[model samples]
Target: MGRHRVAIVVLSGTFVLDLAVAAQAFGRRPSVFAKIRHEPETPYDIVLCGPTAAPTSLGFTIGDLSPVEWIADADTVVVPGLEEPWAPQDPTLLSAVAKAAEAGARLVSLCAGVFVLGQAGVLDGRRVTTHWALADEFRAAFPRAHLMEDEMYVDDGQILSSGGMLAAADLCLYVLRQDHGQAYANDVSRVLISPPHRAGGQAQYAKATTRPLSGSLSPVMHWLIENIAEPLTLQQVAARANMSPRTLERRFRTETGDSVAGWIARRRVERARELLENSNLTVTQVAYAAGFGSTQSLRRHFVSRIGVSPRDYRDTFRSTPEQSRTVGRPQQGPAGTPACDAGPDARRPGPFSFMH
Candidate 1:
């Protein structure tokens, strides 16, 4: 079969890293894979599509790019983040993007580049994500779009978007996995030294909490974090905070935007993830370390919040002597299915969120 065609649309003041992420993923096969017998050439025919010359956000100029009109012929089109997303974009470029989407070409946006798709009117009712800091502005500018700001990346059928700059790599890898298969994407990830699949949303990296803590709840939150491994009840926590259970519950809801139980459960899941990735703890040990009552409790929360089992997550992320034995091997989950499906709804688990 012919190679898939990928067109990366470059705009004025484009963030160079965003452009590079897509290019690196689809542009060429890594030299490390060259000597492997029977290895196929890169499956994507990538072209930089834009005016003859454009200024990047880094104050450098890129010339000799394919014209914007070439976007119409691409099987997939990517828009990298722009330095000034709210500034006016080239009308001709937006028109071409719209045309490509209307023709059923897959559309991708990295970070603020989602603003370009919004301007092209293709984002209406589509689930998408961008840098979390830009969430309010993006919502205001494109209220018709369904914004999942908590996700690191979102795959809404033909339209895909990433939360921030590095997430561009995540979205690209996901698309590659969908087009090829898990083994192929894993090979590319090995070459890039990136995880074949990241298990959680961008919320893990966000510098700010989901909600700002009031003075009354600030100490309580810190205490919770410090004692995350303890199996303390709400009443115990309330006593520690010197408040009635009823008052503490109301305070938690008001300050954290989540019930006390819900907040603690999320934190426990996060703790479990940390132990799985960084420590050599077995699943049961990690479960107890993360404050889950039992292995069953840990598994239940992992499936609900992370979309994968603790064992699968560790196998994918942990650094171990066995890593070389399993790194590029295709993983199978329940009922002999691929550990992670790459279909339209594949990204539903843990979605993606962005920092900054």
Candidate 2:
């Protein structure tokens, strides 16, 4: 596999630690995985930059950062949190990201770096996350981008945004898991002693249960979350909530800012994602349980919200927990594990290429 270059933008007041979370996960090679593959490991090159080729932040001046061109050739670009937004990123840094995205390079930002991605226009029309305290302002600032409160991170395919420094690590581990299989990803997790997965779309932290119920319609939302896989329509949920469809729709938007259909669909997708990542259910089984009624429907929503299909989700996680093997290293046995793995999946494809 050819080495994939990474470019991490560093500016004045940039949080040094946030830089390392990705820097450490991808920047340093662990002795553990060295034995797993014989090919000389692909190197991860990190180029730290500021307004100029030389970064002035980081508590001292440093030089020789190559140019922001590093971002154009980089397979991935990571933007860590800046200290209080003191440095808005050299205009070139933001422009480079735009150029990279146009070229298909994946863009990742942690914490307030969402602001940089926002400025670069990479997050347009995408759902992204940031520290909860800043979510309100972030939304107002970037009206085009949907802001999800309290999510640990958000992986919207080519553009991934994370919650904070810790969430930065989650993003890096996800990259590891994607680039190397679960085995190598797990080994890196063991080496770092961090959990293997924290899905990008999960709230940075669960919002406090302080939201008050209005109009006695909350039970419907609860039921929807629990029965996500069933075929549900506005009339059905309206009937369950004992309200007119218009009233229910208004209430749903008022309480969740999600239309009735959008609300139910998101819950169903999240349910299926939770199970797919944490359970071993087949695409078809998980579909039925999550209320999609069929695997195709489930895959439709799965890709819409999570960016990958159900089978890909299960294949990526089968060797881990949340399956039939809990109380052991594996949470449980997988339902649709890749055929080559031989744990399950009667006709799954050979494992998807990791180095691609």
Candidate 3:
């Protein structure tokens, strides 16, 4: 297959790191399996395109920029933040983005760049995320869009939206890992001086939980996070929240955009990730502790939900310094938590959570 042609569409006064992150991820060479990936000499063709005058930045002005045609012919298109998101964007720019989406290109937006995607109406009926500070604005601007303010990035199928600058880096690393493999992406992370792995639910800059003036679902959600080990049937949760099970489900979906079962699994995964990241839990222990019935069940859910194995998940998001540099790291969590899928299966994204 041909190399994935990546395009980064630049605009006036774009965030510096947003462009830099994509360039670094796509432009750099890989150490492992280089020969297999490239036939001696081939690299990703990263084109920075702009339709108007070179967007000015700190000390550097983008020039020789390609147009949206690059996006049309590309596999992935990244849209960086503009100088002012509150103002209207150029209609031409929005049109180009829409075309790329229709063409089935994986669309990505960094920081406030999600606004551009929203302005184009491409995020309609889609779940998206942006920086927490501007999340309220994003919600107000796009009522139809399911705006996720808590995540570092919302991987809503083909289109992705990141929470902040570092989250952009994390997202790029994630894409790299998905495209190549864990080993190759680890090398890139090493070069970037960042952790080789970051669990997706590690919360974007820890949520600031202020006192709720009223009884919002935030308290119930907070309680759920702390008590994952307790009996948590849907009706039990509804009773605790003082609402009907259906109302509870609706509120939970609105708050987190996931079904009750899905949210529970995600939280279990998040908790499992935390144990994997922070503890020395075996796969069996981790699985049981994360509320997964068995190791195989954990592996199945982990891979399907989080896209990595339990050991691999532990290695990526383990809270402590791992002694083993192997691709998959073994772990055991706090007592009573059985490790899930402790066998040869390496696709288990055990359990993990850091929403606190």
Candidate 4:
């Protein structure tokens, strides 16, 4: 495929991290890193630009950022979030974005960048999302938009929008998956060391309170991952962390942005996804492997969380010979039946009960 041109439009007051996420995901030097025998080449030709080449609010300036109107040739145009999204935007910048969309460029918004797209009239009558904290404001500002509050990202074919700051990476990864397929997307994700995929349906806010975790809980978290299939309880988890169950719950919530049970379920589903894609295991076998206990339970959670059934997901993302090396850290178990490392898909657990 020919290299697709990507123009990332940086507005004044831009959150620097938003721009970097898209750049890193799309600007990956795959040739230097991917040892996979038949890996696909990187597909994007990325450019950074702004309305007038002004420095951002954070004081970092991109000397090479072109003018916003240069986006005319772009196949994809990204708008990064701004600190003061409600402030007046430049008419020229908004017009350029609207023009690009009218010419059929795929439009994307990161976090609060949805405001720019909204002003361009690009999001009218389209399903979209932004940071959860600003969902109400976004709804009020763009009444025509079909705003979904809990989504990680929404892909409405020609337009895509992501929730919050970090989800821009997820959106960029989605672009890769759409362009290059899941294995290639996963390959880029591993390079970035970010979570490979978060289904658009995932809640924007985790169940935990807003506070960040205080101390290191890696030891307990690692142990829990290693022993996911065991029939562990709150007491056991607390004991492993050397804390009382109540304290453990508080700390775990703070540390991971999720409750212990919620985290385990998400991990189990990720394991199921891996097995479905990489292994020829039956859906029933995969259920047991991922600690879902029964195929019925697997189907319920898999569909609810992933927006697809196990069978459908496997069929869509199943590893082919060319894709084998890119999916995960391949390993050999026993007589070399193709075991995976502790990558997302290979962390299958035995029968275990959820501690409510």
Q: List the RMSD of every prediction in angstroms.
A: 9.9, 11.1, 8.7, 11.9
Error of 2 at 318 (Å): 30
Candidate 1 wrongly placed segments (more than 4 Å): 1-3, 37-40, 209-356
* Candidate 1 lDDT tens digits, 90-123: 8888898999998999999999999999999899
Segments of candidate 4 deviating more than 4 angstroms: 28-32, 36-41, 199-356
Candidate 3 on 188-234: residue-level lDDT in tens? 77667777556554242443344442346877777777777554578
Candidate 2 matches the true fold with a TM-score of: 0.55
Model 1 lowest lDDT segment of ten? 347-356
User: Which candidate would rank higher by lDDT, 3 or 4?
Assistant: 4
For residue 278, give model 4's deviation from the true position in Å: 36
Better of 1 and 4 by TM-score: 1
Using TM-score as the yardstick, the better of models 1 and 2 is 1
lDDT per residue as tens, model 4, 1-356: 57888999887788888988888877757574556525545568888878556567598766667888888668899988998887778788888888899899999899999888999888888999888788778988999999986788999989899888888899888888998888887878877788778643534133323343245888787787687655567888888888998998888888778888887787778778778777866666687777776677777787877677777676667755534566555545557765432223422355345631
Name the lDDT of candidate 1: 0.82
**After superposing candidate 2, which stretches have Cα over 4 Å from the reference?**
30-43, 52-63, 199-356
